[model samples]
Target: MTIAARMDRLPVTRRHRVATVAIGLGLFFDLYEIFLAGVLGSVLEKHFHLGKSELALLLASAFLGMFVGAVAFGRIADRLGRRRAFLLSLGTYSLFSLLAAFSTGPVMLVVMRFLAGLGIGAEPPVSDTYLGDLLPPKHRGRYTAWAYTLAFLGVPAAGFLGRWLVPEAPLGFDGWRWMFVLGALGSLIVFALRTRLPESPRWLAAVGREREAEEIVARFERDAGELPEPVENPVVPAESGRLRELFVPPYRRRTAMMAVFHVLQTMGYYGFGTLAPIVLVAKGFPVVQSLLFTALTYLGYPIGSAVSLPLVERVERKFLVLGSAVLMAVFGIAFGLASASWLIVACGFLYTTASNLFSNAFHIYQAEIFPTALRGTATSGTYALSRLASGVLPFVLLPLLNSAGAGVLFTVVAAAMVLVVVDVGLFGPRTTGRVLEAVNSRVGATTDQEAR
Candidate 1:
């Protein structure tokens, strides 16, 4: 079948929506664990008698583990199949989170958190690939945005839980430990819910499980009351997929652009995310006040995602990315400079909202840019680079913050945002309503040769 015809065959159904929600919940918990670490930093310091540098190092360690997990599991997802890979990553992270609660020292905590980060990193790209491939083009932007928006809800959920748990130390357990425990328990719930979910038809087809793929697609069609047109019989090649495919010809430039954008974007993202509360405190707020302010800032994420849902489908993907980056740069600087608590909060709200908007766009953009054959692997590999950059920032940037100031930090972050705007806006092709294969075909012979 022609690419256009295949694109037209996409089924929009209740099953797809159900799958998106289930997969999104799993992602929410995954992100919850990552962000919760920052919330518990002070408690960890008090419990372990850790200095600032030591605490920062512990956070960095988890991100390093995430880098490994994203690259490793991404390949595994592409090769072993998405369902198995998703289940394995989820199980691995949840188990490690539970284990982390029993840590007697920083060493054990760091080790466990690192292992958990590996599991956490594997999920987003894999889930993005799975969701993007399944949804019809017409709803792709909104659905993708909703999925990421749901995942980010975990941020405020962690904040709310931390606000309560950090003070009480329920059951004589460390409040931070409770966070890990709750995360593990939540993962169990996600695992149970996911068992009812089915595999991606696109993935099955890519791997040559045609009958299974057809059956899955048929189920979705039944749910939607409209069937997508079937593609020609897929040819199963010998090579499953490889990391090297990301760097060939047409994809090479795009890959490089995305890598640079992710790196710079994350530097700004982590810079602000890791230090938002600190900035709030530096503005003369008390600890509790700062935490509350930070929580309020994060509360804007879900709201931002929801607000963007209506426009995501209407706007060009690249435009959304560029606009958000510019907004983050502006609000980030404003957030750093504001002296009044109310003004600071307003700036922070805008910054975080813009951050979520850009983030949602990028998640969908990255997954849709690659072919089914290489989607998981490429997304994982590229995203891993961002994680690696983020891992280093805490160690390097935090010290700079101590010596310099919020102004310097925000300025640097703003510069990074500018770079992302330029890279994505200039180079990113319009994938707004195109079929996955059609998007891939535009990537050209270089990517085709690499796919072989």
Candidate 2:
């Protein structure tokens, strides 16, 4: 199907909100587990007596697994089904997280982390694609933001769990092991809840499973009233799924741009998140005190999301992306340079607020830019690149942190954030409040003409 044609079928109804809540809960746990890894890093270091490089390597291993999981399961989600793929990824991570709790050495831990990354990496794209497809263009940004808000809940929850659990190391295991075990158990519970949720109607229709799609849509309507009218139908027949769609014509440049943006953004965000506690420790705070500060910094995430919920509709998404990127660059540097713990904590809070805004907008922007036919693949493909970059930065930055200190490390991240602001702001087309079909039509036409 042509991009324009594929977009005309987005489901619009109150059910979108219901579906969003259900899927958003799944995302919450997914993110919770991913962020928990940073805290777990400190515990693992002490437990295994890992040097800086070894810790970095373990992080890199996980990202490598995430990269593979994202790209591979993304295609699977698109080809197989979003609902099935969602459960698969969730189950994969939950199982591996339990395995991680039992790891006896660095090698075993790395292996389990890699496996878990596969599941973690596949989630956002699938969830974003599903949520985007469910909501109408008019409400897409707000609904998308709502979905992300749930995911960001995991950030603080991770900190809370770390602060509370990391010190205990209950039942002959360290706190880090308990973190993994808790995550595993939580995921299993989420997986059971997900089984009760229905599949995406739009996805089923796109893949020519019209009967199944109608049944799902009927279920949604039964619960939530009527769906909105489709904006347009470009009238192209569906064909076999193609991986090359993302690289062809107009999509190629946007896809490439998004990939670079993802890489740089992750470098900045994860660079700060993963290293902030260590920076606090180096500045003279005790371990427990540093973890508390880390938790305080995360408190800004939900605040950022709550604030963005109402304002996202009023602003251009590209501008919001640019504005947040600049804030991240500026405050991230300030955070690294502050001598006073209070100042550092305040700056870290602002940094996370801006980071949350950037991520929330970026997730909505990227998923909307793609056609329904390839949304999962494109979003996941870009996310995989981002995860890979994030996975490697800690390893690289750890050495720099040891040699150059926090100022130099954050300075580099600040520079990367600046580049991302330029790339996304200058080149990205505005997507605020536009109909999905209209956006895809423009992108498709531009891509086709460029191909010629």
Candidate 3:
């Protein structure tokens, strides 16, 4: 039995849950910072007296930095190893977030935000890749969703914190600045915790360190107790994870699909998540009311992720992406059309829920599509497109929001979701219940075609 097969056959264990929680804790800060941009939008605007372009610049800075971070750190994770990459990314983000809290002006704040984004950007794909490497195949999707359930809590945490603190100064320091300080402190704590985690056994094996891989898997087996007999899975020697490998055959199609998907999906995901407070303010709600409503709506992120736990493994991943995209489109449009407070909140909540469902599905799908050698690089490289689009989104959507109404903005959002449905539904391969090596072994043919 190969190491991969042994890993696949192991029962869910204490070590697995602990690792999931540790990675999820890091993701919590990543999301808290991601959503903080929307939560603090109006407050920052008022404080800095930002014009629309300047405001857009502030909104886009972190995403732009994330674009670079995702691409760079993903490759770094592939080269240096997942454990080291995790520490580096978190430390970079934490240090810069603290700096962001002390910014003297809009320019300074934007610079700090961008620097922080470099760390934030690498987390999702790396988290997905790491969790994919850690968990057994049977419960892989569920545990991944479980980690995200914890991570998504950060969304509502950001919203609630903004509601509480953004409205006024606290203890003579700006409330918003305090938010950054808290994120930095929390991230630093998680960084310390992550240091204790072992490297991915699968990653170690692929890198030709079989002894280390065996030791880690042996520990997991001992911790798990009474695992089933291991199945036979041949160890396909790992390919050199060259950058251009992503541009070749079976992977090339996947890379293209993900790139297009990421670029468009941001319009539906971050389109509302990162801009909702500002949109509510545009619709005549007071700034505080907007933050309150946005916070309420943000509650769906964790809830929606929880919703995916049962469905992520039961349903086909591609179908989940399709269904969630449709829901996002419908609910997004409804959110714009809603005139009553109850309806607005309802639509917003549903939209956020569906978007998170979409998030979990795709995150799992992307991580599973590649082999271990390229998992980090491929996941991060394609995922970077979303960050690029998100960076560009403010310039496009904010201007449109200012000139047109929320209805038009959401119409554009709906259009993006429609394309997402097309992209994933038509092109995505089925991955449920399969081991990672089996999914991406053939060079020219995809797992979907091979299965067929």
Candidate 4:
């Protein structure tokens, strides 16, 4: 039996659940910093006397850090290992986040934020990659989807924490500073616990460590009271991962589709998510009311993720993504048009829920598309565009919102979703219930058959 099959045959158990929670926490903090930035914005502006442009620059700083980190660390992860890269990323972000609270001015704050972003940037793609490696093909979609489910909770966690902490100095330190400090402390604990996460046996096999890979899979099987199917021992072949392969033949189509997916996904995903409160305020809700509404609306993130938990395995990931994107377009307009507070929160909740479902689908899809050899590199390289688009979004989106109104803002978001629907609907392939190696092997078969 193939190592991938061995992994796929194993049952879901307590170990997988524990590891999911650990990885989920890592993803959570990555988002906590992201949503926390919005809460930090008004406070920083008042303190630093930042103009609209400067605040955008500050916001973009972390995203730019993410862009660089994702691409650079992606290659590093592909070369080294997922576990090391995960810890490195978590530590870097945590340490720098703690330092961000100490910044004396805007310049210092931006630099620290940018540094922290390097770690932030590496984590989601890496966590997505790592989780993909650990989970079985049968259970892959929902297991990884559950991680994002937990991760999106970070959005509301930030909202509630920001609401509680951003009003004034805690312990005579800025409330915004306290937010960073708390994120940093929480990350440090997760970093230490991550040592317990088992290395990806799939990655081990791909890198020519089949014995280690088999042993781990065997351990999982033993725990399930079932030994794995027997296979003759042979020295594993090494994977010489080629960057050019991604742009060639079968992979190129997937590469292109994911590129378009990530870029288009980010415009609405982060733009609305991080900017929710601001968007509500722009629509004429009072500041306090906007914060209250944002907190209420954030409840939908976990709700959406939990909804997808069971259905993820039941449905096709491609269609799920398309379905969620369509709902996001519909709900964004509803949110913009609603006048009463309850309607506004209702529409916003729907939008958040759909957007998170969109997030879970693509996050799983992108990682599933490539071989373990190139999974980190391919996913992160494409995912970087989302990071870059997210970084640049505030620059374009904020201006559009300020100049036009929420109507124009959401119209543009809805327009972007149109592209998302077409791209995934036409080009995206189904990946449910297939081993990663087998999935890529079929691609190889296609190319060879075409060549013949």
lDDT of 2 by residue, 58-127 (tens): 7777678888999988888789888888899999999998999899999999999999989988988888
Candidate 2 TM-score versus the reference: 0.92
After superposition, the stretches of candidate 3 with alpha carbons farther than 4 Å from their true spots are: 234-237, 443-447, 450-452
- Ranking under TM-score, best-scoring first? 3, 4, 1, 2
Task: Give one digit per residue, the lDDT tens place, for model 3 in 366-407.
Answer: 999887889999999999999999999999999899898899
Q: How many residue pairs of model 4 clash at the backbone? A: 0
Q: What digit string (tens of lDDT, one per residue) describes model 1 on residues 399-418?
A: 76677877787888899899
* Alpha-carbon lDDT, every model: 0.79, 0.80, 0.91, 0.84
Q: What is the Cα-based lDDT of residue 259 in candidate 1?
A: 82
Query: How big is the positional error of residue 212 in model 2, measured in Å on the Cα after superposition?
Result: 1.6
Record all residue pairs in model 2 with backbone atoms less than 3 Å apart, i.e. clashing.
Answer: 250-447
TM-score of 3: 0.98
What lDDT does model 3 reach? 0.91
For model 2, what is the alpha-carbon lDDT of residue 410?
89
